[model samples]
Target chain A: MKIHGSISKTASFRTTNAVFIGRSIRLSLRNAEALIMAIMLPVMLMLLFTYVFGGSIDPSGNYVNYVVPGIILLCAGFGSSSTGVDVAHDMTNGIIDRFRTMPIQSLSVVTGHVVASLARNLLATAVVIGVALLVGFRPSANALEWLAAIGVISLFILTITWLFAAIGLVAGSPSAASGYGFILLFLPYLSSAFVPTSSMPSWLQGVAEHQPITPVIETIRGLLTGTPIHDSAWWAVGWCALILLLAILWSIVSFNRKAGRR
Target chain B: MRGNVIEVKGLRKKFGHQIVLDGIDLAVPTGTVYALLGPNGAGKTTLINIMSTLVAPDEGSVKIAGYDIVTDKNMVKRSISLTGQFAAVDEMLTGEENLRMICRLSGLTVAESNVRTVELLQHFDLTAAARKSVKTYSGGMRRRLDIAISLVISRPVLFLDEPTTGLDTISRRALWKIIDQLKERGITVFLTTQYLEEADQLADIITVIDEGRVVATGTAKELKSRVGGEVIELFNDKDDLIRTVSTTGSIHDIRQKLNELASIVSPELRVNIRKPSMDDVFLALTAKEMERSLS
Candidate 1:
């Protein structure tokens, strides 16, 4: 019968991930509406914050620089939110059953969505960054700092995409997963995405300062525009690493619980 | 291809307070089409889900292609291809892309994957729609693609959980022809269906379950014989059945039924004798089981 492959262990892992990642990427490209929204919404937000709110927030004309990192994270958030819906659809739909019956690690299914989310957000972030430049946002960072900024942004996307995947696994339906996605999308607003933590109401300052989004955004902002890094990078990487670990664990547990596979 | 390809013992599953499969047992011989027939809510899907390693049975031992479904789940999975009740095909991808996806997952090389995808799409009669998104497919086309995806690799066993549910008669017959081919390839197919004709036409052995319990298991003829003998029928001028007297196919019983029919006979009336079909077998056995449980 020459059944399913006798591929070596490492080769099988590579093939499983490549196949699923390729599947997710193809579907993402096919979804023109979501792809447009992922890029357009963030660019529009950057414009709004830079022109409409930028004047009132920062009269000195460099408000674009202040808001670019935040907009970048928001773009990533939007991209990852779609991943949640995707993961939920796969989990709740009958297609996952087909995958579960195959001789491969099912974790690849969730990771594919996460990786695709990373790739998508990177493109969206690039679009947002380009718009930021056109709107007069200036950065003093050299190549090394630019690389660090991209590193932080990527880790953040991976973290949140896996988080959404966990939510998708736990949600009963795609709509429900998106409902939770909407709630998580507001994370950027509560952080230092658009405003300074010091300028916010004193009582609200603690949350704006302590949340995962704040540290990652501050780290990206610091790397890009020469703001004080001052251990924010450590917190940024630490928080992302911790949440990524937890999200992976949560997704694996829930998927195993649901599919009854290891 | 002689011994059992699938073996289940003491299979039990419960969801909350409802029992789905209760102490069920069955064996499917290699290279045969084994049909599970039951009414709605008979736990057929749950049983298939367990065998395909999509869900763990609360209590049972299931072995597929010599691998334990629980402990050696991967081996069991490698041996089975499942087309669930739903089409389960990716609507976003074209029919050819979906086939290629499964081929890649099955670990085929790039050249082999392309050739296999083209072969499967053409064989499934999906070549014309191969480049179109699956969302554009009709119900029958989607079902055909679903089964084609399952056939991307040669597994020893295939599980189809209500594969033809909601399909039109023509679509169902088309799927039946595909199942017949799978049988010819010596793949042990386990499918669940509520349609008695599907069971009768396709199954080498038909097992009927009712309310989480197996009420009967045998060849179609064996189960029909269990319903026992023929029926003497009386029809009116409108072809309406007037009365039916069941017989054990004995000469004395035939004479007795004929005598009974003579009393109600008239010039405008007609008489006929009919053999019990799988439908009769199903109705009689399910009803008898229900009655037994109620008592």
Candidate 2:
């Protein structure tokens, strides 16, 4: 057979990415239980906090509105964490070797999981928002402010999704990847997701006010509820940008190392 | 090494402190079936991985289809298909979907991908199970599907790493038939296996490796000849091998030995003449290596 000198042009970047993304989404759809659980866990948490603990946390019954943004962020966190498991599963399987021998960019598989996670989280966020409205949420934001809140939420989802993808590439197995991702999920609970940071112990308040998730949650709350954003928006964007950058770099390094060693 | 589809010179690789491939050199000619015959841990997989550009060699140059494996990796990838030891199929996707996925990844249009997928499913006898998930496939079906996936793009070279391993006899023969078909299509096949009968049946040239080194490389006939001449065996009524005697396989030598055995031993013993099979060659060659190393 006549072999050509240039054959890498056969697979374009767009088609390669499209194929992988379609695969990831199809796999997620087939695994309907995981998708439902991701949405259900955060929705269940929103209900628990608004009805069960809202009275003790706040005398007024405005807890639904107060907790919706946190639930959205938590919804995103829950959905994106599966990226770790998916990526780890792919890495540990035989298919990666087939992908490596192909004429396309191998890491498109990782990109597929990240994009799928982002898509799944957005859907879960919408569901959680709908549930919050059905209960008692009444945000005062107009269309532009709502758009801003969505941008922040999507940014947060993208950031953590990439971080989780990196964790998947670094982890030895799917279980280990989820274990690492689970520890980071605590960031949402420790932030101003459920209660005011001031009510926290002075020592704990230092952590609540300073961590990355708090600023992001504060920014979304400000845009949605007309609360003063102060410099939290800038801090939120800055922290997400930094983490996104590090996570991407970490993913590349870990992927290359594992690919070579395997 | 002339007009070879795959060429390697002094290829070396190591994982941590363990050396997997030690200065190995090989050449696989175009439109031929070459077999790498060795036992487990013989570095057969490592060599395939390095040639396929999945792993880098520390000290070697590999050229596949006239493209450097390291410098022009994508070009090399475009010229080859690797069906690994374990079936590398996605268990979650249906057989048809998995085939289409590779077709699309290989730059086929959606229409072309669909046609190709349908053709492959029928060709590999997977049409009835086309819509079923691959997780439910039998071992032979998965292996056939894995090979079918490799053929989606029509490259010049195919690498089968122990293709018949873990397969039943019927599946193994079915795969051998497929290999014969691939040969008729003039696809250069590089397969690795520990089965001497497989190498004997399928390969045009066989290279035997032991402990990360090439111990022998020749045609099946040449390897059998290397084990000396025919062997004479004596068995008792229970059909157990009593003893074997080496021979030059001449008519006179055989007659004299059989007469002497009949006179000194019992006539009730069965006498059988055996030609040197691939098994004898493999054992003799490997034993020689062991002796050399021990000394």
Number of clashing pairs per prediction, in order: 0, 0
Proportion of the native interface contacts kept in model 1: 0.58
Winner by lDDT? 2
Off by over 4 Å in 2: A1-9, A260-262, B244-246, B251-269
The runs of at least 3 residues in candidate 1 whose Cα sits more than 4 Å from the true structure, single-residue gaps closed, are A1-11, A260-262, B242-245, B257-269
* Weakest lDDT window of 10 consecutive positions for candidate 1 chain A: A1-10
Candidate 2 clash pair list: none
Q: Per-residue alpha-carbon lDDT of model 2 for B130-248, expressed as tens digits?
A: 99999999999999899999888778889999999899999899899988988887789999999999999999999999878899999999988887677778999999998776566
Instruction: State how far residue B284 of model 2 sits from its true place (Å).
Output: 1.7
lDDT of 2 by residue, A1-262 (tens): 2222224436788999999999999999999999999999999999999999988888788888788888898888889999999999988877788888999888999999999988898899989988988998888899999999989998999999999999999999999999999988888899998898998999999999999998998899999888889999999999999999999999998887886343
Q: What DockQ does every candidate get?
A: 0.50, 0.49
